[model samples]
Target: MNRRGFLIGLAAVPVITGAGVSVAASRYTPDYEPLLARLLALQGKTLQSSGSWNPSQIFQHLAQSVQGSLEGFPEHKAAWFSHTVGPLALQVFKAAGAMQHPLDQPIPGMAALDPALSVDYALGHLVATLQNFNEATGLQPHFAYGNLSKADYLAAHQLHIEQHLSQISVVA
Candidate 1:
C-alpha cells in the first residue's frame, strides 16, 4: 500500500478494534454549593431515626457497585476495542461511580473510612475513570461497544446522578 494508504489503513485498525468512538467530556459536575446548601438545611435535624435510604447512602452504594463492575473487567479487556450494550452499560456505570466522602464532616457510617476520606469519593472515581478511559483510547477510540465513547458514559453517569437526586428529593 502507498504511504497514505498505509496510514489510512492503520487508522482503520483502531476503529475496527472499537477504539475510535467519540466520548464527550462531562458537564454534570457535582455542584457542591447546592448540595451543601441542602445538607445544611438538615443541620441539627437528625436523619429520621430509621434505616430509610438517604442520598448519601444511595450515592455510596451506587459508587461501590460501579467500582465492583470496573474491577470485574478482564485485564485484556481493559484495552480491548469493541462496542456494544454491555460496554455502554459499563461506561455509564463507570461514570456514575464516585468516591466522594463527607467533605466537611464525618458521615454517619464512615467508621472504617477516615472521616477525612469522605471528600467527593464518587466524583473522584468518575474523574479517575475518565482519565483511564482517555489514556487507554483517545476520543472516539474503538471499543467493544460500537461507537461507545467516554461522552456516552459521562452522559449516562449524569443521568443516573440526576435520577438519584430526584429520588432524594422525593424522600426528603
Candidate 2:
C-alpha cells in the first residue's frame, strides 16, 4: 500500500516471472546437440528399433520431418484443425518445452519409408537433414502445426527426434 512497497512489488514481478519462464524452458528444452551426437556415435553399429519401423525407416522418417519443415510438408491437417487445435497443441508443447505423440505414427502424406535402407546411409541422411535445418533461413509451413517461427520449428524438431530416438537401441 505504501509507495516504497508498491515499487518493490513491481520490481519483483519480472524477476519472479522470469524465474518461472526459465524453469519451464529448462524443463522442456530439447537436447538437440547431444541427441545428434548419440545418433552419430551409433554409426556402423547394429541398431534395432523397438517400435513398428526398423532403424533405417525411423531415420528416414525423421529426416523427412526435418526436411519438410524447410521445404514444406506434402500434406496438412484440415484447415480447421491447423488453425485451431494444432496451434494450441504447439503452444502447450512450447510451454512445457517438449512434445508427446504416438511413437510409431507416420508423418501425414509422406511417401512410405524404405525398410531395406542401411542404417549408416539413413543416419547420414538424417545428419545432413539436421544440418540443413539448422542453416535454413526461411521455413515452410508445418502440416499440422501450421506456421511457426524458427525457434518453434527447432523445438518441434528436437521433440520429434527425441521421440524417435526412444525406440532405437544398439545391438552390438
Candidate 3:
C-alpha cells in the first residue's frame, strides 16, 4: 500500500480499536480509594434514609428482574450484559467516585427500604461494589447470563445500583 493508504489504515485502526478499548475500560470492577472517599463523605448520615431502598435490595431486585427478563429471552442474556450491565456499571462507578459516603456492608432491612433509603444505598453501593471488585481476587464466578471478569461483574453489580438510584430520583 502507498504511504497515504497506510496512514489512512493507521487512523482507522485507532478508531476501531479505541471503540473496543473504551468498552473494556468502561467495564466495572471495584476501585478502592475513590469509592472509600465517597463512603466517608456520608460521615454521620444514615447512608440511607426513610423512603429509600438499600444496596442489597437493589442487588436482589435487579438480579430477580434480570432473571425474569431473561426467562424467555435466553439468547439475549449476553447482549444484555454487554449493552445494559456493562455501560451502566461503568457509569455507576464514575458517579460513585464523585460521592461522599457509599455503603458496602448490608444495611439491615434494606430490602424494604423507602425511596429515600434506596437512593442513598444505591449511590453508596455504586461505589462500594466497585471497591469490592477492585479488592477482589481470582476468577469471577459465572452467572446464568455468562462469565464475567471481575471488572464486568462489578460493572453489572453497579448497573443494579444505578437502576435503583434512578428509581429513587424519579420519586424524589
Q: What do the candidate models score in CA lDDT, each in turn?
A: 0.41, 0.84, 0.44
Pairwise TM-score winner, candidates 2 and 3 = 2
Q: After the best TM-score superposition of candidate 1, give how far the Cα of residue 30 lies from its true spot, in angstroms.
A: 12
Residue pairs in collision within model 2: 28-97
Clashes of each: 35, 1, 22
Q: lDDT of candidate 3?
A: 0.44
Better of 1 and 3 by lDDT: 3
lDDT of 3 by residue, 37-136 (tens): 6444543454332234454355444443333222322233355675655444444444443212233333222233233345445545444444444555
C-alpha TM-scores of all predictions: 0.31, 0.79, 0.34
Q: Highest lDDT, which number?
A: 2
lDDT of 3 at 168: 31
List runs of model 2 lying over 4 Å from the truth.
1-27
- Order of the predicted models by lDDT, top scorer first: 2, 3, 1
Largest TM-score belongs to which candidate? 2
